[model samples]
Target: MKILNRCTLEFTSIPENVAFARVAVAAFASQLDYTLPELEEIKVAVSEAVGNAIIHGYRNRPDKIVRVNVTIYKEGLEIQVVDSGIGIADIDLAMQPAYSTDPERMGLGFVFMQSFSDRLQVDSSPGKGTTVTMFKQMGLRKARARAN
Candidate 1:
């Protein structure tokens, strides 16, 4: 896909930055002709990815770094959230619905990310870190409307 625009953000792995990441990505994505609901989905996906990076990847360590990269294509957009923290040993188990490392948490982050995006991929190793990539295609609403 031809790249139309792109941006990279690096922030401290703090919980407050989740909202910042969400709004920033949504704003960048608005350059496309996405509807309001689609934009909301984009925000939710971003929030979950970033939140997971800070919470699970970094283990709530604010000193760590979380990076977010967003790229826009003619067809849609791609979002990547990366953290250099403890990585997941079992990606398959982690992606399962309501499965969280922390018992207190709901573990629905991946579920929200998967439902909102056209595609979702999680890459991680035991020590390397984690990267969550999500793709949201444009004009999905129109296609769904026509189908119904």
Candidate 2:
């Protein structure tokens, strides 16, 4: 895919940065003329991906680094959240709804990410951490074309 614009952010795996990542991605996504609801969906999906990296991947270790890559394209927006901490041994089981390792938490991060974005992909190695990549189409062209 051709990238029209791209930015990368690396920050400590702290809970606070989750909101930062969400807002940053939303701001970048705004260039595509997304509706307010669409922007909210992007923010929510980004928060889930980043939060998962902080809580599950790094175990709340503030020293760990989480990276976010945001790319804008004519087709849509592509965002990736990556962490270099403990990775999932069983991706299939991890992706299952309500299958969180933490009993107190409802494991619906993947569900929300999948629902909010046009595409979602999870990649991980047992000791190499995980990467969550998602894409959301602007859908502006179609709407604009319809008005003509």
Q: What is the TM-score of each candidate against the true structure?
A: 0.93, 0.94
Residue pairs whose backbone atoms clash in candidate 1: none
Kindly provide the TM-score of model 2 when superposed on the true structure, using C-alpha atoms: 0.94
The TM-score of predicted model 1 comes to 0.93
Tens-digit lDDT string for candidate 1 (1-148):
7788999999999999999999999999998878899999999999999999999999999999999999998778999999988999999999999999999999999999999999999999888999999999878665355335
Task: Tally clashes: model 1.
Answer: 0
List candidate 1 stretches off by more than 4 Å.
140-148
Winning model by lDDT: 1
Which residue window of length 10 is worst by lDDT in model 2?
139-148
lDDT of 2 by residue, 21-50 (tens): 999999988987788999999999999999
All candidates: CA RMSD (Å):
3.6, 2.3
Q: What would you estimate as the lDDT of candidate 1?
A: 0.93
